[model samples]
Target: MRVLMVGWEFPPYVSGGLGTHTYELTRKMPHDVNITFFMPDRGEVSVPWMDIKRIKTSIGFGPYMTFGGSVLKESIIKSVEDYAKEVGKTAKQTDFDIVHCHDWLTVMGGICAKRENGKPLVFTVHSTEYDRSIGNPCPWVMDIERYGINEADGIIAVSKRIKEQIIEKYGADPGKIRVVYNAIDSSSFDCGLKFKPTEDLILSLGRLTLHKGIDHLLRAAKIVIEHHPSAKFVIAGKGDKFKDLVEMSIDLGIEKNVFFLGYVPQEDITKLYARADVFLMPSVFEPFGITALEAMAAGTPTIISKTSGVCEVTNNVFKIDFWDTEKMASRILEILNYKELFEEMSNNCRSEAKRITWDDIAMQTKDFYESVLR
Candidate 1:
C-alpha cells in the first residue's frame, strides 16, 4: 500500500504527541507499504520507507500557538493554502493508494489530496479541538476538524473517549471510527535502569496547560513535601500556562519543593525519566498519556489520570483522578517509601510497555487502512 501522509509537524519541530505518533508509527512501518509524508516545513532528520515532502510555503506555521491570535490564524490559513496547492501537484505526479492525515492542521490538504487524486481519505484524530482548548476551542479549528470527521472515508481515534466525542459531537458514523491506542518505542532507552533507593524524585513531564492539570500537581507537591521533606519534584516542558504555573507554585509556597525546568530537550528527557523515582501525569482530560508510558519504559513507577486512554490499555500502573491531589500525593509517597512495591510496579509497567510496540501499532493501522480501501 502506498500512502500520501499529511501531517502538521514532524520530528525536531513537533510540539505535541501527534508528531511523535506520526514519526514513530511511520518509522516502524513495514517496507512493503510505501509512505510519502508531506510536512509543512523542513526540519532535522530523515528515515527509510517514507519520503519526506517539504512543501514550499509563503507563511510560517509556528510549532506552538494560541487559537485566539489573529495573526497565527491568518498565517495558518496561508500555510494551508500553499500546502494544499502542493498536495494537488504531488497527487498528479505520484500514485498513492490512500491519503492519511494527522489532526486538523493537515486535514485541509488531506481533503485536497483526496479531491485531486480521488483516493480514499483516512483522517486520524489525535485529539479534538475541544480537548486542546479545554472545552472552549476556536470555531474555525472546530470547523476544520468537523470537515475532516464528516468527509473522510475513515477515522482513526487515538482513544475510545476521543472516538466517542466524534460520534456524539460530530454525529460521525460509528462504524467508520476505529479506536487505535497510541504506542511508544521502549528500545530508545538503551541504559538498563534498576530500582536504586536514592533521592525521592517526583517527575511531571508535559505541556504546562490548564487541561494538563499541572496546577493540581503543584498543589500535590506541597502535601508530599510536608509529609516527606527530603523529596524533590521536577516539572518539565513548556506551554502557555508556564507563567501561571510558576506563579501558582510561588503562591502555594512550594516553589522550593518544585523545580520547573522549562523545555527539556527530548534527548535529555529520557535521562530524567530513568532517574526519577515516580512519574505523575495528572491530566483532567487527557487523550492519552505517552510520557507516562515512556517513564514506565525506563523503569519509573508511574501514576496517571483515570481519564487517560493509557489507563484503558494497562492495569499495572496506579490510576487516580486528576482533581484528587491528596490521593496523588499519597500515591507518590507510597511508591517512594516502599522499595519492594516500587520495584514490582516499575517491573510490571515495563513489561506492559514491552507489549506495546510501534510495530504492533503500525500493523493495526495497516489493517485499518486495508479495511477502508476494501
Candidate 2:
C-alpha cells in the first residue's frame, strides 16, 4: 500500500507530538506499506525508511506560535493554500493508494490530493481548534477543519476524546472516525540511567499555551510548595504564554519554587525525564498527551488531567481534573514523599509503555488503511 502522508513537523524540528507521531509511525510500518511523507522544508530532515518530499513555503508558520507576537491569520491561511496547490499537482502525477493528513495544517493538502487523484483521504485529528483555543476557537481554522472532516473518506483520531470532539463540534460521522492511540519509542527513554534530583522535582514539558493548562499547574505548584518547601517545579518548552505564565508564577508567590526553562531540545528531553521526581501534564483538553508517556517510559511517576486522552489507556498514573490544583498538588506530594508509591507507579507505567509500541501502532494503522480501502 502506498500512502501520501501530509504533515507539518518531523524529528529534530518537532514543536510537539504531531511530528513524533508522523516519524515513529512511518518508521515502524511494514516493508510492504510504503509512505511518501510531505512536509515543509524546515531543514535537513532525513527518513531512511520512506520517501520525504519537502515543499518550501514563503511564510513561517511553526507548530506552536511563540510568545508575545501576534500571528497574522491571513498569512497562515495563504501559506496552507499555496502548499495545497503544490501538493495537488504532485498527487495528480504520483501514484498512491490514499492521502493521509495530520492536523488542520495539512488537511488542505490532503483534500487537494484526494480531489486530484480520486483516492481515499484520511484525516487524522491529533487536535482540534476547540482544544487549542479552549472553546473559543478561530472561525477560519474551524472552517478549514470542518471542511476536511466532512470531505475525508475516513478519519483517524489520536484518542477517543478527540473522536468524540470531532463528532460533537463538526458533526462528523461517528462510524468513519477510528480511534488510534499514540505510542512512544520506549528505547529513547530506556538508554539513560535514572538520576535522582536533590530537590523534589516536578516537571511540566510542552508548549506553554492557553489550552495546555500550565497556569493551573502553577497554581498547584504553589500548594505543593506550601507543604514541601524543598520541592521544585520546572516548566519546560516555549509558546505565547511564556511571559504571562512567568508573571502568574510571581503573582502566586511560587516564582522561587518554579523554574521556566524555555524550549528544551529533543536530545535533552530524556535527561529531564530521568532527573525529575514527578511529571505533570495538566491539559484543559488534550487529545493525547505524548510527553506523559515519555515520562512514564522513563519510570517517572506522572499526574495527568482526566481530560487527557491518555487517561483512556493509562492505569498507573494519577488522573486529575486540570482545574483541581488541590488534588494535583496532593498527587505530586504523595509521589514525592512515598518511595513505595513512586516506585510502584513508575515501574508499572514503564511496563505499560512497553506494551504500547510503534510497531503495534503501525500494524493497527495498516489494518485501518486496508479497512478504509475495502
Candidate 3:
C-alpha cells in the first residue's frame, strides 16, 4: 500500500514525543508498504531507513512555530493551505491508497489530499489542544480537530484516554476510533552507553508545560530533598512553562537540587537514563508517556502518575496521582533509599519494556490499513 503521511516535525527536529513516535513507527513499517512522509523541509534525519520527503514552504517551521507567536493563527492556516495544495498537485501524478495525518497541524493537508486524490484519510490524535491548553484552546484549532474527526475514514488515538476525549469533546463515533498504543524503538536506545553517577539522580523528561505536571514534580522534589539531601533532580525539555517552573523551584527552596536542562539533545537522552537512579513522570493528562518506557528500557526504575497511559502496559513501576506530591516524594525516596527494591523494579521493568517494539507497532498499523481498505 502507498501511504502519504503529513506531520509538523520529524525526529531530530522534534520538540517532544510526537516526533519520536513518527520516526520510530515509520522507520520500521513493513517493507512492502510504501511511505512518503511530508514535513516542512527540515534538514537530514538521523535514521536512514525511512523514506522521508521534505517540502519547501515560507512559514517558519520550528518545533513550536505552529503552537506559538503573534502570527500563529495566520501561520497555521497558511501552512495547512500550502501543504494541502502541494499534496493535491502530487496526487495528479502519483497514486496513493491513503493520506494519514499525525496531529492537528496536518489535518487540513490530509483533508485536501483526500479531496483531491479520492483516497481514504486517516487522522491520528497524538494529543488534543484540550489536553495541552492551559485554559480555553484556540477555537480555530478545536474546529479543525472536529473537522478531521468528521472527515476521516479512520481515526487513530495514541491511547484509549485520547479516544474517549475525541468522542466526548467532538462527538465522534466510537466505532470509527481505534485505540493504538505507541511503541518505543528499544534498539535505538544505546544500552552500551554507560555513565557513572556522582550523585543519586532523579530524572523527569518531557515538555515543561502545565499539563505535563512539572510543577507538581518540583513540589515533590522539595520533599525528596528533605529526606534525601544528596539526590539531584534533572528536569529536561523546553516549553511555555519554563520560567514558571524555574521560579517555582526557587520559591520552594529546591533550586540547588533541581537542574532544568532545556532541550536535551537526541544524543544525550540515553546517557541520562542510564545514570539516573529513577525516572519521574507526573503528567496531569498524558495521552501516552514514551519516556517511561525509555527509562525502563535503560534499566532505570520508573515512577509514573496513575493518569498516564503508560500505566496500561507498565507493571512494576510505582503509580501515584500527579497532585500527590507527598506520595510522589515518598516513592522517589523509596526508590533512592532502598537498593533491593530499586534493583528488583528495574529488572522487571526492563523485561516488560523489551516486549514493546516498533516492529509490532508497524504490523498493527499495517493491519489497520488492510482493514480500512476492505
- List the RMSD of every prediction in angstroms: 1.5, 1.8, 2.2
Candidate 1 has its poorest 10 consecutive residues by lDDT at 59-68
lDDT of 1 at 245: 90
lDDT, ranked from best to worst: 2, 1, 3
lDDT of 3 by residue, 118-234 (tens): 889889998888777844677788898899999999999888888889999988999888888888766655374333344789999987778889999989999999988998999
The whole-model C-alpha lDDT of candidate 3 against the native structure comes to 0.82
Off by over 4 Å in 1: 62-64
Question: Cα lDDT of all candidates, in order?
Answer: 0.85, 0.88, 0.82
Q: For model 2, where is the 10-residue window of minimal lDDT?
A: 63-72
Q: Assess candidate 2 and give its lDDT.
A: 0.88
lDDT of 1 by residue, 26-125 (tens): 9888778899988866655577668888776674644335566787678787777788778777777878999999887788889999998899999998
User: Candidate 3, clashing residue pairs?
Assistant: none
Where does candidate 3 stray beyond 4 Å?
44-50, 61-70, 190-198
Candidate with the larger lDDT of 2 and 3: 2
lDDT at position 289, candidate 3: 92
Worst 10 residues of 3 by lDDT: 189-198
